[model samples]
Target: MNFNFLSPVSDSVLAHNELLSAQVLGRKLHIHSKQNGIPDLDGVSIAILGVLENRNDVNYIGEEFELNEIRKSFYALFPGSWNTIIADLGDINKGESVEDTYFALKETISVLVKKNIIPVILGGTQDLTYANYRAYDTLMPMVNLVNVDCKFDLGDSQKPIKNNSFVGKIILEEPYNLFNYATIGYQTYFNSQEEIDLMNKLYFEAYRLGQVSKDITIVEPVLRDANIVSVDLSSVKGAEVSLKQKYSPNGIDGKEICAIARYAGISNKVSSFGIYEYNPSKDDELTSMLVAQMIWYFVEGVNCRVKDDDFSNEDYYQKFITLVDEQELIFYKSLKTGRWWIEIPFLSEVNNKLKRHTLLPCMHQDYIDACNSNVPERWYKAFQKNCL
Candidate 1:
């Protein structure tokens, strides 16, 4: 039993009416209570874990866990058309130090992911994403991470890691498995010019808030390419979440964030998901319910996921090849889901951990760009990263 790594949800949090309504998810969730044992993982597709540590946040002055409030709001909501078993593993209280909490989270998430159970993390701070990424170190050869936030958070690698600088640690740390990092809804005023330039120099992708709000569907292809998704509630408008940081007056609204969450859940490559920077206050109910709805959309997306990775079987996909810059660009569209992918030629032997995949996820737009003789930057970056 990994019970040592977690604490049962407080009795007060589960004090809801026993009456089970078909709509209320609290009635159906296998919550980890003091009396009941841990839920079986046999058919479970998603596990919810609450974390109560935030010392690493750049603005940290000490904060309380929003778990109970979040729980109250989340449990009261209705589930969508989902058949997957969802379990609440309760909360991880603050450890001795920030690193101590990081250790607990890393160790805990590592085992669950190894078992192929997707963990939907209710987080303390965005810095915990470093631990989320670390959990996949030995499980996979490389990783593709997507962060939904208003800042790149690419603080100095030379300094101690904080919520704003965890990405720098992920990039410079050992067992380097990060292949791609994409940011959605980044605002120009929040990120420094150097950090912005660093993104381009490192070949990472960043979509401005206006770009995403203009075309919400554009985020799906990016999420489809990610392995881990970390979302900062600060990315949402302050009017929506009453954000602690008060970071942005302009941000993605409630609907867009949930859409992004659903897209993350729909991605076949996304193994673990996290929602961070939730600071509970007088208006906790409003923010908590919004966050809960986002989680619901993710669960709905998971239930609606369709497998389309098999390109070897000619019957499963339609192939298209276009010549651009004297090089042949190959694309595959899933016959079942209509999703798209582009082939990045692998020069080495097949089946190697690093070579398990050569096809990078793309969108229909990429094919159109290729047809117009414009080489897709994403394809080029993936090609460069793989060949090196």
Candidate 2:
């Protein structure tokens, strides 16, 4: 029998330490420890956490990727880094129970954030997002979340621990505001209208890629204020390729997908990010290579932002807003003096012309009143400011 799954670690020729000791492109890595002979990145708190094993026996596992393959790929793409990737080899299927994975994830995240490290998580399923959010609970007072997926993953969990609707349970239980969350690339077939309606009712931002394919420029401002980003690979495509989803056909492509990932990474506000639904059995070598490339670009975006920049918030806001053109879409910029006035796209009402800005933060209730009422005339006249 192929007893590679004997335990979390193996005592074979290619020891776990030997496999995980590869370097990243430009940065030096530090391997922390070798528990059970599985190599942990030393001094490198930032991580790419992959919950590949689950106790629920949910048929989520497809084919597993070789650690050597992933490590070598990372080294080729990022040559100078000492250690940027690590995997948990614990026998996730020891039983059909929740296991200590959730606790381990929570502790791991706490350690990284405390040390100012960014964690790039890969999911066994969408359930990991809930655990991730929970990890950040005490650390972040107010969090802005961006979800790029085909479905809301909000099915009723009363039946079983389904990945479908676990996020719903999380939102209902957490004090976080729905408006702070944005769901991008939603497909009509994957989600119910009721789910969509529920999202809108909760004031969550939701965008349909069916309507905005090339106009993804609008994504800039939407995420400019967000602190967390979670991605589901199913949102990209479901094909037989190594990295594609099993059920999705209509989705974004590799290059365009990377652009979006780069966007999120460059935002600098992102504390945590994830990619889900990768089946190594179904994945092509090219697909595996692309996964490594995507991870590289993610780190590239992270390194681009400087920590001590003092650019006025207005500067970033204006720059992000300028990314959207009025020629293609009729969006009115709501400008309030001495307060942040975000661009609100009246998309559903606009001749169905402009790409909708979903999950965008509207100003406070008072500002909303002003934007809705005739107060703009007084405010406009008071400040000799021109509305572009």
Candidate 3:
């Protein structure tokens, strides 16, 4: 309820919104403006927030940016045939220090999540993701994060918390609530060997750029089990984004990124979503439009969500059992959605962190792999983490 840290949307954007057609999203959303303070949250399913903090960027040189352009692009777009209500709660300006900014972000997102309202954050730097993770500390026992990035971002925890190193802080910091961390579209050259080794040792998931581009559906299961989904714009290809925002020549394309966003939206567990590392520029129209499309696809997916994971009703899902290496694997296929899940046996005797994560979302291929006598990698990793 304490959103004093938020600033109203810019006057220019509001003026532009007035010129847009009534059918666009600008007219549909309940917006925060100078004239109308904060909008009522009653029946609001999604809230859009912007955070203006990037002092922690490793390549920072005292440059500042704004989210007005992204807002304009998002507002001008047409909405899908959806039933969810959205509100733009405006932006959070930079605080006295980076930690102060993080605190404000944490508090704001915490309030939204507690109300069962998903926050769609447009951010300055990806390090804000650490604050996003912290927002869940009191809400959930353990958290699963799905980061769509080109790097592992597991910098030295002893060093200062830079945008590239915040993940390490999340893992090392007190009140460890992180249950699992996964990275999608990771470029091998961008990550050091030690970070890759550490990821393997930690039993965290990492999907290469080529792996995801080859088949985007691989990320669906990973996202299905996620509680927070954070995306870094730098993971997008140089040709697909603005000059200032591009970081790689080979990365996820605009279409693929939008597909990933839609998958994130469809997941029942994903409560908070963020797209970060935005660098506004004069020639950022293309990037802004792509970001808008990504948001649109996410909203579309959210409207299509189905409650197909309930196993209490025997007729809702069909169960299958297979054995590989003398180990029994149980798989369930949703009769409503055709999605699959593999069961992770509860280790009641051992101190288990995954007592609540018994059903692991998986693909049909995983069932085929188990039928061929090969243990699915996702199931193996989850089982290993549970035993740890």
TM-score sort, best first: 3, 1, 2
Question: For each candidate, what TM-score against the reference?
Answer: 0.95, 0.67, 0.99
Q: All candidates' lDDT scores?
A: 0.86, 0.54, 0.94
- The prediction achieving the highest lDDT against the true structure is 3
Pick by lDDT: 1 or 3, better one? 3
Q: Positional deviation of 133 in candidate 1, in angstroms?
A: 0.8
Worst 10 residues of 1 by lDDT: 349-358
lDDT tens digits by residue: candidate 2, 1-388: 1213223322331243355445434123332123434344445535655565433335655444333344335445643232333333323222234445665666666666666677777656667677677777778665667888888877775656556666776676755533356778888788898888877655566778764476675565455556778877677765524544355677766765676777676665777777765555533565556566777777766655543222245443232222222222112332322223333344343342224432232224324545344232212221211111
lDDT of 2: 0.54
**Candidate 3 residue 357 C-alpha distance from true site, Å:** 7.0
Best-matching candidate per TM-score: 3
Which has the better TM-score: candidate 2, or candidate 3?
A: 3
Give the alpha carbon lDDT tens digit for every residue of 240-346 in model 1.
Answer: 77545345679999999999999988988889999998888776777888888889999988888898988889999999999999999999999999999998886
In candidate 3, where is summed lDDT lowest over 10 consecutive residues?
A: 348-357
User: Which stretches in model 1 have alpha-carbon errors above 4 Å?
Assistant: 17-23, 243-246, 347-357
Model 1 residue 288 lDDT? 86
Ranked candidates, highest lDDT first: 3, 1, 2
Per-residue lDDT for 98 in model 3? 91
